[model samples]
Target: MNDSENNLKRFGENLARIKKAKKMSYRKIAANCDLEHSDIKRYVDGKINPTLLSLLDLAKGLGIHPKELLDY
Candidate 1:
C-alpha cells in the first residue's frame, strides 16, 4: 500500500476502536453524522479515504476531536 493508503487504514482502525469503545455501531454513528451507513463501513474497512470535512463530521458525531481519528 502507498503512504496515503496506509494512513487511511490506520485512521480506519482507530475510528473503529473508538466507536466500539463508545458502544456505537456503524449505522448509528453514520446516522448521527448524516452519512450513508455504507460510507461508515467503507471507512472502517479502510476501503475509502474520507475527506477532511467528512472526518470532521465523523468526529463531531462521535463527540470527539478530529485529531483523535488522525492520530492513530
Candidate 2:
C-alpha cells in the first residue's frame, strides 16, 4: 500500500486495539461523543479518514489523549 493507505491501516489497528483494551463497543464509544456508531466503525475499519476534529472527538469519547490514537 501507499504511505497514506498504510498509515490509515495502522491508525485503524491502533484504534481497534485501544477500543478493545478498554472493552468499549462502537455504540458505547459513540454515545460519549458527537459521532455515530457507523462513523466510528468506519474509522476502525479503515474505510474512512477522519478530520482533526473527528480525532479529537474520538479521543474524548475514548477518554484518552488524541495522541493515543496516533500511537501506531
lDDT of 2 at 25: 98
In model 2, residue pairs whose N, Cα or C atoms come closer than 3 Å (at least 3 residues apart or on different chains), thus clashing, are none
Best by lDDT: 2
RMSD, model 2, all Cα superposed?
Answer: 0.5
TM-score of each: 0.91, 0.97
Task: Please report how far candidate 1 places residue 68 from its true position, in Å.
Answer: 0.7
Model 2 regions lying over 4 Å from their true place: none
Query: By TM-score, how accurate is candidate 1?
Result: 0.91
Q: Per-residue alpha-carbon lDDT of model 2 for 20-64, expressed as tens digits?
A: 999999999999999999999988888899999999999999999
Candidate 1 has an lDDT of 0.87
Worst 10 residues of 1 by lDDT: 28-37
lDDT of each: 0.87, 0.94
